[model samples]
Target chain A: MTYCCALRLKDGLVFVSDTRTNAGVDHISVFRKLYTFGVEGERFITIQTSGNLATTQAVIGHLNNHLELGQEPNLYSVNTMFEMAELVGQTLRKVIADVTQDTHNHEQNNYYCSLLLGGQIKGSEMELYNIYPQGNFICATEDTPYFQIGESKYGKPILDRALIYEMPLDEAVRCCLISFDSTLRSNVSVGMPLDTIVYEKNSLHIPNGKRIYEEDPYFRQLSKQWSDTLRRGLQKLPIPTDDYLD
Target chain B: MTYCCALRLKDGLVFVSDTRTNAGVDHISVFRKLYTFGVEGERFITIQTSGNLATTQAVIGHLNNHLELGQEPNLYSVNTMFEMAELVGQTLRKVIADVTQDTHNHEQNNYYCSLLLGGQIKGSEMELYNIYPQGNFICATEDTPYFQIGESKYGKPILDRALIYEMPLDEAVRCCLISFDSTLRSNVSVGMPLDTIVYEKNSLHIPNGKRIYEEDPYFRQLSKQWSDTLRRGLQKLPIPTDDYLD
Candidate 1:
């Protein structure tokens, strides 16, 4: 299981992904679920994936191996974020079809994987897209400026309360980290060693995002402080009436 | 949809349930998901249901309508908390079987629902159980003293942090309420008014259980104060470093 989230805030876009992958309890391994495309002063995009590690890796590998545009559309050649999303969906479908072709000789299984794409082109606004397992996608709009995939439930409450289209990029990144921290504490399937990337809204370049491990001072402080804050908040609330039970 | 949770604390037990039900987006109504039974002085048991409303209601109706001693074997006469949990599970399976019998011709669909049972019987300690759709149940242990059903994710973080086997009954109740408030804020499908029941250990009877509506002053205050507290907590956190964007 994985948890990846990206928020397109006023200042930039914040992307974070956990690196835990598991075939089963005993078969868990660390696999980077994030991939970046392009370099400085050009089109930059970061992709995060969850579900069916085999399928996700295959789709990403196929795209990476054939990124050039010779009338053959691919991630690097896509002109806009919309086109990039379509390319991702098309590639996902192609890869799944290739892998499932021999299923009858084996056992039939549904291919499952989803992706989060967020980046900025030179002239366009930073945007975020949630690509579904079925090779389709939806973009985040002003009404909802973030997309989350994987073990999303344990971390959803804070985002629903604090995330907004107008939030500063720095604050939004903090919010995403706190959200991920909540999920990591609650679910064993999502572990530490997070990969985070930030793309300034109009920079059209990739900034070197931090790789947070168990010892990252800022993350450690945030996790401890957040839990402490919640405990304090809960303790301060007045006790309810004992009338009904008395 | 609904959200129901039961916590077993050293001092007692806490149970909370939301009342909103819907067949589709256009058909939403309020229906209590909690049912209580007791012998006044000997025992008290509270059950909260989630999943298909019809299935849950049918199961409850089966318990309420049948009065014969051996024939019913309902929650009312159960000797132990485990037996009470098993009775709820058996009732659920029976209800599903009865409903699915006509599915072939009527296309009414499968029955799906779960139950959270918690309370005490004479001369016994307070306990909690999560009864599944398949007529099997699991008891909450000292390490895991809480169970949640229906639209559960949004409200799980607080419980993960604040719940402990030795938490005070009052504090447990407050934690459950805050959890419910978080769920209600995030998911429209789970709404109030709510039904909350707290059982004091060894008493074998529930005295602090009641229905809470939107206008309930205590609930209103708790929700408002929780929101204010959360906002303040977020504000107190340190601002992200400028490196956060990189």
Candidate 2:
């Protein structure tokens, strides 16, 4: 029901997420799934969520609650990005456990949700992680360099084909949006506008990134031109040797 | 698992399928999923299957049994493509139902399978139908001229971007192969050595179609060139307006 991706490139980290949330067909709504946390220049972190809306919101709420209440072991209290990931994963797992406690099916994951956690600490390396519904997490490595959660397959081929570890930050942004474009066109559950955030490594600050609305000229042109380019490119490919069959 | 796609284009029909079949990672094997049946010069029908291999093979077996026994309403006796579609659907449904009858869970569909049936009968229009496991089928119209079954999403965006009912048959075949290439790259469940069959509307007879092995020269060229083109094409797309942020 969502298309969210984050990449850890040479220059920085890029996070992108769709805002469409749906509960069955009739209960569709727009909700921002991108959240940023940490002390301004000391650290920068963003979490893009997908799956059960209630659970994701509840997880965010609990994390915020920790911050607001000045809990001893909160987002602000974490030092390295690894601890931040552990805290977020623990909180996510706890929230799902609390919400689905009344359900008889322990295996029922109606309340399960996942998150893409990415950002950097003051002196730490830029990092990206895919946090699982079960509170486990995996870090992005040079070979992986990125993570995508929810409605990922339709948009994945392009990323697999084009994205690289050393990609320029600007090109990576376009690549993610193009991935998003593929998803938005094929799946109704993932809609515009997309929320994106970019964090420069060691700058220890995160910008609001960009919100690409459906009507944004650049996005519109990008989507249309990409489709046109694909059509043209497909035509350019040589036909089979057995054209006589035609 | 498998990746099979069928396109109903203005020129004719194109069916493409991967040969990977795996009960588990350790038990992987190669098996053809493309099949043809008809009374040549009168009717030519091709079926591309996906899902439970046993169910699909059993369905094929039953159809062959009917023909061998000279049973009424056999594939050879079908007068129209619609009838052919119906016969395939019924056989598929019967094969699944019979196999799963001993299991108590009616909701359990471990034996489920799906098929894409396409071809023409003398004096009738060329038609393409997607037959579901429940013995129901839907025909492809101008607006929806293609059907993909099994591990479909990874390869779908390219088709959505370029395939059209009026597309040239040669181009359609190439497009289908590219789609297969995408799926094969992203999924271990779908594998190499593609089987492709092209049918010209009134040709009435069918050739054993092309087999594209992993080492095949043209296929290797297309796959390599496609990745190169995509990488180049991706670089050409305009970066976001916030390039200064980089």
All predictions: root-mean-square deviation over Cα? 3.0, 1.5
lDDT per residue (tens digit) for residues A1-246 in model 1: 899998877778889999999878999888999898875787889999998988999988888878743446876678888998988998888887787787874332456789998887777777789998668999888898888999998888888877888877767777899899989988999988999887877788677878888898889888888888888888888888765345
User: Candidate 1 vs. truth: CA RMSD?
Assistant: 3.0
TM-score of each: 0.91, 0.97
What is the per-residue lDDT of model 2 for residues B1-246, given as tens digits with 9 covering 90 to 100? 899999888889999999999998999999989998877788888888898888889988888899999997888898888888888888887787788788868554778999999888889889999999998999999999999999999999999989999998888888888899888888899998888889987788876788888899888888888988788887898877763253
Q: Compose the digit string of candidate 1's lDDT tens values, residues B144-222.
A: 9899999888888898887889888888888899899888887899988888887878777656578888898888888
Q: Tell how far residue B50 is off in model 2, in angstroms.
A: 0.8
DockQ, every prediction: 0.57, 0.59
Which residue runs does candidate 1 get wrong by more than 4 Å?
A68-72, A101-109, A241-246, B66-76, B98-109, B239-243
Where model 2 places Cα greater than 4 Å from the true spot, the runs are A243-246, B243-246
DockQ (model 1, Cα): 0.57
Each candidate: what lDDT? 0.83, 0.87
C-alpha-based local distance difference test score of model 1: 0.83
In order, the candidates keep a fraction of the true contacts of: 0.60, 0.52
CAPRI category for model 1 = medium
